[model samples]
Target: MDDVVQAQTGTPPVRGAEIAVDGLAKHYGSLKAVDEFAINIRSGEFLALLGPSGSGKSTILMMLAGFEVPTAGRILIDGVDCTRLPPQKRNIGMVFQHYSLFPHMTVADNVAFPLKMRGVGRTERRRRAAEALKVVRLDGYGARMPSQLSGGQRQRVALARAIVYEPRLLLMDEPLSALDKNLREEMQLEIKRLHHELGITVVFVTHDQGEALTMADRVAILRGGKLQQLSPARELYERPANLFAAGFIGEMNMIPAQWDGAALTLGTGERMVPPTGAVVGTVGQGAVTLAIRPERLTVCDPVTPDALQATLREVVYAGAGTLLIAALPDGTEIRARVASASLPPALTEGETIGLSCPPEAMLVYGEEAAA
Candidate 1:
């Protein structure tokens, strides 16, 4: 595949084109499917559009792919306005959740379909088709029909077909959602590798936070037809912009508190300081939500200052760690994940425990934050 692409295009196969979406929006009557969504996708960057259902991630993707026209705004590919172009004229490729391979076509023919439509010569199409199959590690399976392949292999075929033309941009809409957990994980790595090898700008949409965090160079989180935040996985996880972003990315223990200049006062009379140099412009206005991740907390003897006293209500033993769910003196519940080796051997439900975390590990957000 690399050889064929290089031979024909006179450029390395692993480079990508840039894309920009400006104030993109879609409307269904009075309902806004996507509103004022905008972002720049760097060349060769893998970006994920992540959000819950009806958040407009898919609607934005559809607009970009030309499947759905934006009610307003424009889409640019490598600085060219492609907003009004048809899907085929955009020189973009797409893969859907359902592996849309034609059951009647053999694998090679399936991959060659796009080239055939584009008027490539028969000889070149066959060569490129075979090379594409090999690129996906499906070299000798070209003669096999779609029904003869596994779900994952069929998806690879779909991918091969999408990429055989070496599209400048690739749009994948929940392509891995159909597979079981293990296979889904396996394909995640495969897709990541393919992105690196091909260097094609990719815009992927999914509701799975884990997938977005694991695969994307940057993730754009959306809700209520608005973008909540766009950042790298680590930053999005460790320093979320607001309460909604904090709670949506991963499991967080959100405790209601009142912020003073130096610290937060929990309802139970416990004072917790924010990490040094942490921004708190919104913390002083009114009530705030102090967010802490489960792994950042430690369960210990109730003798330390800055620790909250709680009663363990449940102990969940995950394979790698134990999760302790506890209720604070004010009746607020919190969770902590302790490694199996460090958990107290005799820990029991209803036992008193102290939960502590460094002040720097806390995220404070204003009360009016919305999803």
Candidate 2:
């Protein structure tokens, strides 16, 4: 990729393009797939568009790749408008969920296919294909067919093919969704390394929270085709902007409560000090929802002073800790995580237990949190 990238003495050049999307929307008749979506992605930054099914994550990706046209708004790459640019002319590479390798072509020929489209000579295509294969660590496997390689290897070939031309941007639409747990994780690191080495801007799409949090420099969360929150993974996890974000990012126990800014009254009518936690979202008055992480809660005897009372419904032993599932008086079930060694051996289902959390471990949201 000599012509593709300029090597620095000791650092990677930012060969990626900065992108801007403003008022981007897509509509299929009455169905709005994306609504006023906007974001700014810096050069060489790895950004993940994360959301559940039908949340417009893929819609935005396709628009960026020029495979889908927007009903409204504009896309700018490197300060130039590309909203109407053809996919082939955009110089954007994409790797899909399925490894779309050519079954009839050898690995070398598949990698060289893009170059051939641009009318490169046969000799030069062969040389470039060999170099691309080496970068993906498939140097000698180039002679093999796609059917002969494992799923991971085929995916690697697809990646090499995408980066072989060193496009300014790389778009991945859940590329590891087909792999098993172990291999998916392995590929995450592999892709991250490649992004660092190649310095290419990447817009990754995934519904898996772990994958988004683990690999992205920042994550843009979406729901029902609208952007919910965009922030660094840690900020998104620890300082969620709203109830939906607080509940979606990870496992959270939302409890019904009443708050007056200084104190909180539980659903069971027990009064306690309000959460002194770092507040990130709107904390409303009257009926409210108190949110806490399962890992931050402690399970104890019902007689424990100041602890909320609950009936143990089940116990789950995870590798690092035990999960305590309990229900409050109103039948609202919640979870708590405790070190396995600390669990009371005599505790059983139907036994009354106490749940407590430090003031700083909670956040208060409106009653809509229950919905």
TM-score to native of every candidate shown: 0.96, 0.94
Return the lDDT, model 1, position 264. Answer: 79
Q: Which candidate leads in TM-score?
A: 1
lDDT of each candidate versus the true structure:
0.88, 0.87
Q: List runs of model 2 lying over 4 Å from the truth.
A: 3-11, 275-278, 367-371
Candidate 2 residue pairs that clash: none
In terms of TM-score, how similar is model 1 to the real structure? 0.96
Q: Which stretches of candidate 1 lie over 4 Å from their true place?
A: 1-12, 279-281
What's the CA RMSD of model 2 in angstroms?
A: 2.1
- Backbone-clash count (model 2): 0
Q: Write the per-residue lDDT of candidate 2 for residues 51-127, one digit (tens) a residue.
A: 98999999999999999999999999999899999899998889999988999999999999998998889998888
Clashing pairs in 1: none
Across 24-77, the per-residue lDDT of candidate 1 in tens digits comes to 999999999999999999998999999999999999999999999999999999
